[model samples]
Target: MSNVFDGYERQYCELSANLTKKCTAATALNGEQKKQKVSEVKAGLDEAEALIRKMDLEARSLQPNIRAVLLAKLREYKSDLNNLKNEVKKIVSGNINPSARDELLESGMADALTASADQKTRLMTSTDRLNKTSDRVKDSRRTMLETEELGVSILHDLHSQRQSLLHAHNTLHGVDDNIGKSKKILTNISRRMNRNKWIISSIVLALVVAIALILYFKLSK
Candidate 1:
């Protein structure tokens, strides 16, 4: 289960990094190239979104504490992906236009200058957003590592407790065997004592009969 999450996280980070680099490079390209890059970034975001949904489903089958952390992280990633998708769409639709200085220069000098400035500001904003997303990815990675470590510790403790209980159970079984042997020995001794008492009573009865016969003979003489 931990391995599953590890795989998902690795794939997510790799794809996200690739997409961010593409977005940065797109800023310097012409309209057609920028559109192509935006399309590619959108595809990557879609893949990442699928991975998050998979993680969310897996988390639901886990323990409550673990589920909560995983779900929270999933939500954060989903929100970031949504924002990224919107930003990429804006770029594609000319809302967050990149500089086309040479083409705009034919129109008028003032219009070209203003458009260039707006494009630069929008690019800067996009860069800032990318940096923030990178920071969040780092934080999420750290949290996942902590959660994995905690789960390992819990499993180790449970295994130790099971071993202790098994040892105690074996010890009690040995004690019960010793007690059964002692009871058998005591029963044999009791039977021997009863046999000795019966033999002594028979000998005393014979001696008393012999003494009575001797007295009767002496009186007859």
Candidate 2:
């Protein structure tokens, strides 16, 4: 989620800023420059570890929310499916009223099962993406911390911080793009479901009319 990434980005910015400040501070460290650099690096790594923990918690929270959404959708679909089955039984047994039975058979509830299946598929895809992104972020953060520990060169430290900032910026942009794609997919599915519902309604209405005419003729005889 953007929340988790934003948290990391905020820390990354703070770390980068601190690194810049320390570079200036390093110049006047006299005999303690190396010690001071190590201390700053350790502090930054600790901040990174804290950020990771926060993001991990956020990621774990997402799983339950996602599962709850999927479960709710499944429950709705199951209820709709049961209603659809009842409608089919009535149609077959000649128990359906001539008016509303056709709508039940053809409209809003007809393809509900299919939509539910699609939703499950989308949920799985989203889960996979979330996992992959989380892994990448964790790995990158670990690498950054490790790099920080490996005896920073004064010139190399500044350069690395600049690069790290740029990397973090680009990574956050990628996360934004991914979230956008997920949103787009969900929107398209919603539109498709609306169209399907309209079509199903018309078909059901026609079926209901035909049943009504047949019943009226039989009754007149």
Candidate 3:
């Protein structure tokens, strides 16, 4: 930016220097040379004035601080142009027209100010857009974090449910083992009861037979 502005400043300086040289020569020369020098000075002044307006327009695109500095420089260039115009006026008609110069200065300053205002408005609009974009990014990031937390919670719930299912399975397995042991114990008790019943029946039959034999022997005696 500075390079471009510096180029323009250098060009304006060269034009101003050339115009000054022409205005100075117009005073010391004869008929044709003096007229030619005056003509060159007028042409140079027009060119320098156009360049100043161009620089003013260019400054509107610069940073506000930089534009302010450029504007100050532009005003100084305008002053230089005014001085050159006065010199040319003296050379041609030996008169100074302050009114025309004043009107032109006021108009240029007004245009420059308008351009600066427009630049400020554009800068503010751009800043607003950037801030909105930043907010949207923050919202997106927060949503992602919330989603991640929800996913973690769901995984934890699944793990707990899995553990509960495993515990229930283990409890059912223990119950089945206890039922098998109880069935085995009942089968052993039934076998012991059948053996005792047969023993009691055999003992009762033997006693009855022995008592009958004793009665028969006593009758024979």
Q: Rank the candidates by TM-score, best first.
A: 1, 3, 2
Residue-by-residue lDDT tens digits, candidate 2, 1-221: 44454445345444434433443343334445646664665565456446555644554466676646544534443353344334334433444454554454344332444444554665565567678888999999999887877646656888989999999999999999999999999999999999999999999999999999999999999
lDDT of candidates 1 onward, in order: 0.68, 0.58, 0.75
lDDT, candidate 1, equals: 0.68
Candidate 2 Cα misplacement greater than 4 A, ranges: 1-155
Error of 1 at 127 (Å): 29
lDDT tens string, model 3, 1-221? 34456556667776776666566556556578878888888888888888888888888779999999889978988987898787677768734356754554464455445444544554465556567877888999999999999999999999999999999999999999999999999999988888888998889999989989999899989
TM-score of 2: 0.29
- CA lDDT of 27 in candidate 1? 52
Global fold similarity of model 1 (TM-score): 0.43
After superposition, which runs of candidate 1 have C-alpha atoms over 4 Å from their true positions? Answer: 97-221
Residue 202 deviation, candidate 3, in Å?
Answer: 37
| Off by more than 4 A, model 3 | 94-221
Give a tens-digit lDDT track for model 1, residues 44-112.
888988888777778888888888877876776677567557656555666443255233233234433
Write out the backbone clash pairs for model 3: none
